[model samples]
Target chain A: MKRLSEERTKLVFEKLTKYLGDNLKVLIDRPDGTYCFRERKDRVYYVSEKILSLASTVGSDHLVSLGTCFGKFTKSGKFRLHITALNYLAPHAQYKIWVKPSAEQQFLYGHHIAKSGLGRITENTPQYQGIVVFSMNDLPLGFGVTSKSTADCKHADPMSTICFHQADIGEYIRSEDTLL
Target chain B: MDVVNAILEKNVNSNKSISVHKDLELEIDEGTLLASDYNVFDKENLRSSQDTYLKNLTRDNVQVLINKIWMLQTERVDEAIVGILPKPVFVLPRARSVPKPKPLTKWQQFAKEKGITSKKKNKSKVTWDEELEKWIPKYGYKKAKADEQKEWLVEVNDPTKFTNGEDPFTASKTAKREKQAKNELQRLRNLAKAKNVKLPRVGIPSTEHFRDARQLAAATTIARASTASVGKFQSRLPKEKDAKDIASHVPGIKKKRKEAPLSVVQEKQRNKKLAESILRSKSTILHVDAPVPSTKSAKSSNSGGKKKSSKKEGKGAKKPKGGKGKRDLRSKVGGRKRR
Candidate 1:
């Protein structure tokens, strides 16, 4: 698959915006090591330790980078960002999000991995390819893309995100469905 | 010894018939005495019921013979004591008690006379009376005309279902009786009221409240005569409201009034009236035909000054000429003599 461009990411964001009505949040990690979050207009923004920790992982520099990225993606739509719950609660991101694609948008297979900020890291890494999937952690122990297209992108290193690939995503989604 | 076989059989009997009866009673005494010193009979005594000497002897006699043998050997009695004894005697077993017959009850006798044995159970059979439309007892109904049955068929089912539903039929009968009673009571009430006889109070606590024919007639008469009929027809009213409204409608019965609230002027006037009344009673009020003032005039009258002067004069009049001799009657009523 080709790298997700800014335009393509916007289309994905736009599709995800539908689910934002259904209480899902969207987030992105920038190359500068900072993070940005997306929210529904009706919902109040709450910065919990979890989002703060995720932002810490991207660092303040990456946060600024993610802000620019998100700004470019969401040209017209508005959203609020919150950095909640530092370190102790970053991995729960996948289950809390339920993205609704527009009737025309295809249901992206690895779209959920983006919520945990792993996709940003994996898409930028030289060793990654295709779409990276995130599981329970930001560590490289999980599965990720192993294609040259994803590796050669001009984005920051995505090794941390790529490690959490499809298998991890499958495990997390199975557990969540079981809980339901 | 010389004669030897002389005359041996000189006279051998001409003809002889021989019959032998064994009367056995063995008595052994081997010098050293012991109760079981020797054996007499090897087996149990033989038993016979008829009278051949052996037949005459019972098993008990045989047992006695064995005990004698032991006794003779152990006690060493004289031969004469042994010889005097006849054949052995044996034990006789105890007889069993006879069983008594049970007496039959009258019902059982009637059952039998009808050829109905206790062992034979009679099942109920119901026959349809076409004319009156009821199932009648099959056997009993045979004597009665089909047109005479007055009962109507309420239900019909298989014998099993019929027997199981006996209790429900009984319940229906009781409820029917109750409904009949209620209808009769309503009928009686209507007739009594039409004749202007009071309908006795239906739900009162006293026993007379029961609306029997006589009481109903009496109550109706009373109500018709008195204007008290205003509260009589309350069958349509809700119970609580009817009871409350009925009391008020009863004529010539006055409800007690609540105490009046007195205004300041009225209160002062009342006090003044009470004081004057109290003063007058002490003097002019005690005189015969004094004509007590009405409540209104008493309030305006000033009797206080005149009452005091009159009281002094009254005291002087009351004093006897021989002052201390007579007891004062007025003093007995209101003076120091009244405890």
Candidate 2:
């Protein structure tokens, strides 16, 4: 079995965040049914995961939901978290992500969790962690492995996609079902 | 009556300097005061109307004042007239009249009375004679008769033949007249020989000798001088040219050339530039500024604006003061046009 290292996961997310720095206003949607986006004051504009998720809803089966994330998150405002997400969609795992405020709940969870006496996540000292959730109906509960994906690099936030090597997941949890 | 008598009698002995009276007016020379009047009109009795001299003067006194005014106007008082006045009187001395004769002397009187004329006469006299065609001898020769005639005949006749004449004039070389005739014949024979010309035996005077002796002598001198100059010039002339050229080379002679000297290009250019410069200067002095196009445009715009504004205002319109009217206003307002 292989487990994903925190350093390797963070490196993948950092490469995606670099594209989304100053020019773009990005949006994301979380699985918990919350929407997140940044809007400009002068121009009417919107970018969101609902728009991104349309790619999947249209029966684009090649779209992968790696259910992994990694990147920087900052609590710079009340009820506001600036998450620089480096996410991946699959079957061809193209990194499409942005660094901006996340979907409403995602932003609240990231912002509230970081500011509630959590360890400092600065530029020099960044958080590197991830979660990999398996399908509960397809697997027997407590029988399937639910080991979180981790990488040692830096900047892990809630919606930041953390990609893992299939062999590394084998190192942490043995999966009897075929790899999706 | 007493005042009248007093004024009439006016002590002519008392005021010796004042002279002449007319229109019952005492015409005093400019400075004499009416002392008698002044004495009667003195300050203590100044207001005594009936008896006082000032009261007695009446309108008659104004004549003297008028005369004084006239004298003041016409005569400029000077120091000489001032010196003539009495001690108390303030005489305004007048400018002197033009000078007159200082009375005649005895000699002038005698001359004037006698009516004398100058004795000196102009002695010069003019005379004319028609037959002689010149003035004949006057006082001097008229008396010296036959002797003078003999000398005149001797001068007019040929020097070689005077034997027909005997009483030879005293004015001539009388003692040597015969000797002169012989010498003249010999001289004429020698002259013929020297010139290689034939001699006439009965020697006659040259026609030139009949002319005035002085004229003949002058002609001979002029001929001699001309001949000498011809010889000298002939010897000095260039051998290359003929007598025609020599004649042309006569002293003081000048020849005219066919063409004048060519002018330098720079000189022509300079003259052209000078002419152009004068033209430019003349034009510049008279150059009036061209009427401004902008003003014309503004004028047209103003007319248009007035028309449009009138249309907007409807019917009862005011015409703009412009064009000739503006010019008239400018002149009337005494504002000089800027241009």
Candidate 3:
């Protein structure tokens, strides 16, 4: 396989830095033909072999996939986090909602979670902002959009809906399987 | 002379006509004609006449007399023609006529009578206030309220609410960062909770043990050696070669071979042949005119000359060999060039 050119590597780095952060370190291996990333704290993450191979099929206009989650690098050089990317970003992310097992199933099935099923909601989460959803076991379920403000969520009824699920593994699988 | 006397006798009988001739004779006798004055006369002989009576009659008075006689003859002819010919008939020009305007439609007529210009009214315009940092309606309270409500509805899903000045990508980045920070805090809290609470361990052990056939054989051999002999069966016995040799016999061993160096003469000859071959290949590909390098001195001299000539040429013009010009000619002749 041909290795990425210096210009392409620089473009990828710029995009990743904008989306991920300024502290991200991207390394390209010419011999092995692999891409790897390290955060500010020196935690290294490798681009999945599957995604690396998929890079060949991607068009010139397509965004680069950074990690296993295939978090896309937009044309504007910002990273749009996919649900799979949450596994890598969960540790460093700010707001998270721990859902009940039932709610987790519902969330993966592409249904929004109600306030009652939420085990915990982080403080100061703004309304309509992007958020990460996790299961009871601490596995990142998916990403979601907050439907209510932090203050509103506090005073609202227990059954009131909190977040609208954005992306999940179940949705990805459904999209991939033609038989469905 | 008889004709002249007849004309004079006829003029004397008409006293009114004779009165005009008498006035002409009086006007002519007032001026004394000169020789220079004769130049103004149309007839050459009349201008050079020495008779004083004719001299007193200037060219102007003679012309007036001729005009009066011509006018009298023309007037008599016109009068006789008018008596015989029929009168001409004239037609007067008529004024242009215009068509009446079409009757207006019922709605148009009603609108005209009511003095209503248009059916729809001008909507209230809204402008952004720099001081207040919000959009304000130019009209009344109702319009302002409506604008506010519309703004509120749009603001709900507005991604730029928090990141107004930033681009869409940067705005999304800020949102993602905010989300990540929240998740990290929650994770830390969960980690604390797990530390404080005593949770039961679940699932199978992470590490696994496997027994290989070779490992089993080696273990048995080691056990038998320990039981049978203390110092007899060593890993590397004195009778055996090194472990590498044993590994080589096992299979998949790559042994490194040392290459032998060529003699000076052979090396020189080989290098010369290689260089000649390279030059030949290059000449074939590029169609260079220079001969192949058989000897070092000849090659060096040729290259030096070529460099000097190339420098003199600077950037040479490209020759269109086997190109459009040649192809067009070959096509016209219906013949292909040999490769």
RMSD of each: 44.2, 50.6, 44.8
Ranking by TM-score: 3, 1, 2
The number of clashing residue pairs in model 1 is: 42
* Order of models, best lDDT first: 3, 1, 2
TM-score of chain B of 2: 0.13
DockQ of each: 0.00, 0.00, 0.01
lDDT of 3 at B170: 56
Q: Tens-digit lDDT track for model 3 on B1-339?
A: 999999999888755332222332322211121112323333655656656446445444555544444443232374562222223233325476665665554455678999978755875477776655667777766654654555443333455465455455455558779988987865655565545754444575233221554544444344334534532554654463323333343332235564455433343344334434433443342233233333334324434333322222111122112112223443322122234
- Model 3 chain B worst lDDT run, 10 consecutive residues: B313-322
Candidate that scores best on TM-score: 3
Candidate 2 chain B worst ten-residue window by lDDT: B312-321
The parts of candidate 1 lying over 4 Å away from their true place are A1-180, B1-135, B138-260, B278-339
Candidate 2's C-alpha runs over 4 A off are A1-180, B11-339
Q: Model 1, residue B307: what's the lDDT?
A: 31
Candidate 3: Cα lDDT at B230: 39
Which lDDT tens digits does candidate 1 get at residues B12-90? 4422212222355334232322122133433334323234434433333544444544444232366444323333343
